[model samples]
Target: MSALRFAEDWNEADLSAVHAVLVRSYWCEGIPRETLARAMRGSLNFLLHDAESGELAAYARVVSDRATFAYLCDVFVIESRRGEGLGRRLMERVVAHPDLQGLRRFSLVTRDAHGLYAKFGFTPLAAPDRGMEIVRPGLYLQSTSERAGT
Candidate 1:
């Protein structure tokens, strides 16, 4: 974590830097800038920066009520910074965050990185049959078009 800085304030992060990184992420491809800005406004965002360069190096956000539940999402590390272990440090800060502890449920969805998350106690849904969702993959593609009036 040398030469790294961590921040939670929305005003401290560059909105365009975040949007640019996210639009390239597998999970958030084509996500609109305004949509992301709105989501950040409502969520608890964790950001890592290069202290020397002032660049956004990694990020993760959690949608929580500061109570019994939290949905961890949008976890990403800038590609140029991937091998530096920023991802692990980001999760370390998230799971240990004061508001996220002792919850009955702290959850996330990851197409990969299971091993990293498992080290922090995330697991396969104990009851896959018990969990359900109204997943709408690529649901944002239409929105992008609509916003463009295409």
Candidate 2:
């Protein structure tokens, strides 16, 4: 195996590799290919690729204005490649990227991977605070139908 590689930006060529990693590692149930394609175009994504094979191993993204705060999302590593520190390496870049330094807070929502995220200084929202989503009923239903078709 080769040392891990990191890329701060991704292009069209990298999307399929990244989608495969996300699907295999995350079991990302309902996300559309178009959505992933759009996210890859965001300016603040951090991507880690396998150095020797150029396969995407893990990815973390931040949505920021280059000030104030940032949200970290979609952090994952391929199952066959876990326990090798690629997730940590990907997060180190996400947390320490020049544009993200000195943020007031960085946050994420995870259903189960709390232990993995905690190592990078992420913690649950304190009492009196909670995460909430304003679901768009139409979009939610549409995505559900699309996912069922897949």
Candidate 3:
């Protein structure tokens, strides 16, 4: 395997690959491409590449205030790329990002991958009861169907 190259720079193709992964993931299933585009514009995006093939292998982004809080989201390593420690490498770069340091809190919601996050010092929330959210599962699909009047 070629060495992995990690960076914040991204282009349209990169975003498309990231979107492909996101659309299949439970966390972001049915996320609209335009919506993902807007989110990418407003967040700090990290991408990992195959270096040799120039394929986007992994991705993650942080939506943050750069001073007090950050939400890590859309983290993925393509199915063919797992078991290679790329996920750990990706998280290492994310948590160590200069702008993400000393934050009052950094958070993410993951249905699985607890072991992976744990390796990066991410633990179960100490105050889960204090956290609340308005979840709209399948909202994107719903919106699409509505748009088509189906």
The lDDT for every candidate, in the order shown, is: 0.88, 0.73, 0.90
Per-model TM-score on C-alpha atoms: 0.91, 0.79, 0.94
lDDT tens digits by residue: candidate 1, 25-98 = 77878888889999999999999999999899998999999899999999988888988999999999999999
Clashes of 1: 0
Please list the Cα RMSD from the true structure of every candidate, rounded to 1 decimal place.
Answer: 2.5, 3.9, 2.1
Give the higher-TM-score candidate: 1 or 2.
1
Q: What is the lDDT of residue 51 in candidate 2?
A: 86
TM-score of 3: 0.94
Top model by TM-score, which number? 3
For model 3, give the 10-residue run with minimal summed lDDT.
140-149
Over 1-150, each residue of candidate 2 has an lDDT whose tens digit, in order, gives: 577778876887677766766644433544566777776677488878888888877877777777888877767777778888887788778777899888887778788888878998888788535656664423422555563666
In candidate 1, list every pair of residues with a backbone clash. Answer: none
Clashes of 3: 0
Name the 10 consecutive residues with the lowest summed lDDT in model 1.
138-147
Please tell me which predicted candidate would have the highest lDDT against the true structure.
3
Model 1 misplacement above 4 A: 143-150
